[model samples]
Target: MTIESVLSNNRIIAATQLKDIKRADESQCCAMILMNGKLSELMHMPMVHKPLFIHMDLLKGLKNDKEGIAFLKEFINPTGIVTTKGNLIEAAKKEGLLTIQRIFLIDTNSLKTAIQNIKDYRPDAIEVMPGIAPKIVKALKQELDIPIILAGLITTKEDVLHAFEAGAEAVSLSNQLLWNGTTEAITTK
Candidate 1:
């Protein structure tokens, strides 16, 4: 499918499994995939076909973070740094990385703390958990200019379709399932 296709078109983005990432990413069937961790294993794959999205904690925990971030800047910046710190959001902006601040799983106080981070750090998108609630999606869309991407328990084509219909611009693939880049979920004949 073309990149311009609607978020539907069964827009499948395969999640990288910890050990299987290399094989899964290299699998010819999967045309659209996102990966976390090191890229050395994926060198054989064409860069245009392989898009990478990384967890913030993994990036931050790198032994040589400066070098790692420098290398990452070349291909797919962190989708967003999942940080309780919120300060890292500012750093991401300064370093010119698109960010998604993962909250919702944290406590009420941390969630409250994250609101100001949105104001100050100004991420490109903010994600909510366990699927997007229309009310919450509306509030976040109105409160911030950034788009929303929903995470967790978002399975099946209906769930994915309902999410964007509800106001989320995108919904992350359930970690338990990766599309393997095939058009099986694409709903194309």
Candidate 2:
């Protein structure tokens, strides 16, 4: 399914990097970015009844290759995957797994490279890091047709709103308080 279909009404994803597993399991967000814990542990965790996107960078025992992508799809059984590697994203897509390519806008050069690479990889979605940059978000949105998920350093309601205004399809945040707060706001609206 498309990332837009997965996102649905929820414009915020619960990023479980530093989050307690119990809290993440009870999160109100419709999707969870699993950044910690082993694949075995994650499958057993009482997570919220939502789609889970495994973070490939944090996952162990998986090679970043076609065979590895097949293994992840068959064994891990995640709804999607998050990764910065262009090759992995491409391979994952071929494996019928939704791919969210993480792009860190460290500089103009990095942004340029990401744009070029994304054109080649064409993941299901693009997650721009340091989500605080509305201008960059706007620029990327203008250039790319894929869904955009703003992640990292998103700590407040204003930050989330700003990202949306700047053309981010959604925002991924690790703060549980912000997750609940955003859920309330999204539902109320």
Candidate 3:
């Protein structure tokens, strides 16, 4: 499925360990984001039916550079990549892989820098961390046209609801409990 379809259809994406990949695949989550993995682990990663995205910054033994992205495209071959670097996003775009720019909003300066970088690079999507802030999500939605994926520090069902209410296109979390059955329950509500 296309990235847009994955994001539009699945409100909750499972960000899980490599060992939990199968669980994520079986869960209701429409996509999987592998956060902590080694280059070797990814090289031997089990096949996942859903869209798989690897956090490039978290991968061990892989440089967050164009060469690393090229290697992933040629071998690991995930549906997309999550990274904090704009140059890598450009490189991933060149390799025809979907890109999600992960931005950590620590303060006003950081947020402004993130916004500027996003506008300059223009990845397919943006993932805002410490995603419990509905007000920030609302502001970001007003600032950018790209799809926003809220992640990090999302601990409750209410957090998910608030994120959607703030105009987030999707919410990604590592909670296995939520991954199993949250979409139908919350979306239907």
Candidate 4:
């Protein structure tokens, strides 16, 4: 799990920029959209008005491009999370954007590497995944000062509870047998 485990209190939003904003579940959810996808397409979304997060990959492609920088500055102003490497993170920071790197899955070695990598960048936050147990989260939090947002494979209120219990601050979910609506979050601690 990653920073989503920590950042998402009961009412966290999964920032999205998808052209089709699925019916939003306001109880607790994310407003997410594809960075590469057309933002105008998002207008078709029923919940386009919701706060959304632009992915990092989208920014990476535009890295150091003046036009790309200007576009991001003007068009996507809300908080965005990017899963980029070190150099790209610096470029984004120069552009006044704080991005969180995506750590797809954490094994012992991978988690160790991610922790070190994130520490070097001191990103806005760090995300971890593949059903990371809470014990590991506590360890990571203690080892790294950055907030850890859990992502990947979360599927239930129980998963939310477990993540919180494991010391995660937020959680990201995408079609993992979990409820599809953003409002479907648990009243986590």
lDDT of 1 at 117: 74
lDDT score for residue 112 of model 1? 62
RMSD of each: 5.5, 2.4, 1.4, 4.9
Q: What tens digits encode model 3's per-residue C-alpha lDDT throughout 1-189?
A: 456887766688899999999999999887889998899878888788989999998999999999999999999888899999999999999999999999999899999999999999999999999888767987787788888999999987888888888888888899888886555587565
| Model 1 segments more than 4 A misplaced | 1-12, 18-48, 59-68, 71-85, 105-111, 132-134, 175-189
The TM-score, computed over Cα atoms with residue i paired to residue i, of candidate 2 is 0.89
Summed backbone clashes in each candidate are: 4, 0, 0, 44
- At residue 53, candidate 4 shows an lDDT of 56
Tell me how candidate 4 scores on lDDT: 0.57
How would the candidate models be sorted by lDDT, starting from the highest?
3, 2, 4, 1
In order, candidate lDDTs are: 0.52, 0.81, 0.87, 0.57
Which lDDT tens digits does candidate 4 get at residues 18-137? 533354333235444344454454333343444455664653334544455456656665445466576656655666765677775446788788878888887777667665465678
Q: List the pairs of residues colliding in candidate 2.
A: none
lDDT for 177 in candidate 3 is 82
Top-scoring candidate (lDDT): 3
**lDDT by residue for model 2 (57-160), tens:** 88765667778788888876778899999888988888888999998998999999999999998999999998988789778877889999999999988888
TM-score of every prediction relative to native: 0.63, 0.89, 0.95, 0.71
Q: List the candidate numbers ranked by TM-score, top first.
A: 3, 2, 4, 1
- Least accurate 10 contiguous residues by lDDT in model 1: 1-10
